[model samples]
Target: MSTPLDATAIETIQGFDAEKRYKHLVKEVVANRKIWILIDEHGCVMLNTDDEDCVPVWPNKEFAEAWATGEWDNCKAESISLNKWHSRWTHGLEDDELAIVVFPIQDQEGLVIYPDELDYELKNQAKKQR
Candidate 1:
């Protein structure tokens, strides 16, 4: 059975008039720089990095639902646009690392994590391994 749309999903759909509008936003943001929005099988959202595996991104709810059933482990996927995602969560990030923000339905305050100190820490780890 298809999952019912929640408040966030409804707001996201209404925010963009059509799928084309959503695609246009994605294209516009991606034109400036590569952007990735990471969303798990649940509603949790994060900012994906270049080093991570490719995650599916759907322009609208219909597409997300279709993919969610057969391919995405039967879990509903909710995503925010790159700009909206950045605006909502980027303020919490430190200058040195990639940020992962988790938005849970019950909680008003989202959790933010900087996985590593970006290039500096990763490079140091690499050097130590060599």
Candidate 2:
């Protein structure tokens, strides 16, 4: 199965084509079918996935780290578990704690992961301990 990061790889190669082609590719990811799409400060597509585990989708770990350090703009990571979404700049303004946007992927009505809420969480168990 294609992981959440794989979705971002596809977008990087495809860039932003016409809507018809773009929608077709996005539909392949059940989570992106109804999502908004994440773009970096440079207007580049960031992440795309439906799985709750896959969020805060940045161009890469470097980009995510850069955002955390206030080096970039034009992107934000949303959490399907936290119910909140904010830009990199907004998130950085918070305390030293890693700010994340978590929300319910599925509300009472149905499941929907907004494109703007797209993000890929880094699987660094060792780092979490710090």
Candidate 3:
């Protein structure tokens, strides 16, 4: 049986186009154990989970740059255990935002890379090509 938290999380994701993390939770082929945590380019983890929906607050060029280079230290004062990458993004509102946490699809060589971090690096690299 699904808990109330699970149901609400699914509902929230359904309402948004991009922020919705649980958009595919109901599909028969969905991966139930998979979890994603949102983060900003600065490597500051956001406050939402894969099961929730969040609206991007604004676009930060610096934030984008940080993610691209895997420079999380600029955004976070404390050291982050997950060295792969992490991020922080504001919701449209001044105080609201979302973070999507993602883990490796499969553990590679016992090293777990955060999806948010990996995405930033990949995206950052792509941006440079253009």
Candidate 4:
């Protein structure tokens, strides 16, 4: 599960540009300890961009929930703690050559980054929080 976000907060974040949202996502994910992803019956959703196969992530359930429309309507917003992300996801995604789209919104795909890049950002953000 992920932390609850107020509707107004979600709306505010939704208005931010992709990079700003990505920065906010890194900060909030570090603070909250949860990285939100969307999953359906089969497994995690994968999006293909021109250059990468990306798994989208969000800072909170509200942001993740906002993406679950149309084809992803049946998907559920699930949380992966930062610990699990560091332990499992980074290496797994790196080996699979998958990128991450951070905090995507209805109008745009978010910042696309390599798994290790995201992991590094998360660690740096965590350090700042400390």
Candidate 5:
């Protein structure tokens, strides 16, 4: 079942101009192969269910590893390409009441921050650590 949006997640979404930021963020993620944690409003990691075209993604192995160990209070963390994630998983979400946030893949090492504000080298390093 889809989870509800929480206060922090709502604040994050409302803090940005979604229409203007969505395309730019997508470009940044695709160009850098950056990992992002797709969290619903309630801070639950978005997962790939029976859907074929859509899959949940993390920016790096570190974040994925944490989620796997229930660090994020969840047991599953999956990865998907930015293209499919944007076009498939997130499709129609903009019109729904539910809001999703693209959080930078962060671990104990450091934070990747946001999708639009990612350091390519740092992201790559995190991936390599996996």
Candidate 6:
């Protein structure tokens, strides 16, 4: 995020298809070394897709902040370093059977994946970056 995010970039990124967004998510998350989530005083927010409990994540703060409206109006964007995600989130989400929705927009559900699955992809992406 060295460059300031603009409305045009936000629109373009949000317009990308889920697969494209998923690729962007991996690259950006690895490059930035953090994952963004919406949080309130209690904790991170969760969205439900049928019976599944899913945590929504974004590539950066701006994107995450965009969703902090409606029911999540009180929420704020929170960043989790990749280290913390690996050390705590993976196991905790696995135990809870919660899935992650990567870079989701208001209308579309992004890639819904398990924490270990995302962990694997992110690790692979980071290795490639190195």
Write down the TM-score of every candidate.
0.30, 0.23, 0.18, 0.95, 0.35, 0.94
Model 1, span 24-121: residue lDDT tens: 32443344322333355564333354553223343334544544433444466465544453454344344433453222111122233343322233
Q: How well does candidate 1 score on lDDT at residue 110? A: 23
Best by lDDT: 4
Clash total of candidate 1: 0
Say which prediction, candidate 2 or candidate 5, comes out ahead on lDDT. 5
- Cα RMSD (Å) per model? 15.4, 14.2, 16.8, 1.3, 13.4, 1.2
lDDT of each: 0.39, 0.32, 0.29, 0.90, 0.41, 0.89
Tens-digit lDDT track of model 4 for 1-130: 3457787887788889988998998998898898999999999999989999999998888878889999999999999999999999999999999999888888887999999999999999989878
Ranking according to TM-score, highest score first: 4, 6, 5, 1, 2, 3
lDDT of 6 by residue, 52-98 (tens): 89999888899899899998899999999999999999999999999
lDDT score for candidate 1 against the true structure: 0.39
Q: Write the number of the candidate with greater lDDT, choosing between 1 and 3.
A: 1
Off by over 4 Å in 3: 1-110
lDDT digits (tens) for residues 1-130 of candidate 3: 2222355653443354432222232121122211223245644343333454332111112222323334333442222222222232211222333333322111111122233433454445445545
- Runs in model 1 with CA error above 4 Å? 1-51, 71-73, 79-83, 89-130
**Top model number, TM-score:** 4
Model 6: residues with Cα > 4 Å off, grouped in runs: none
Ranking by lDDT: 4, 6, 5, 1, 2, 3
lDDT of 4: 0.90
TM-score of 3: 0.18
Candidate 5 wrong stretches, greater than 4 Å: 1-28, 32-57, 68-74, 104-130
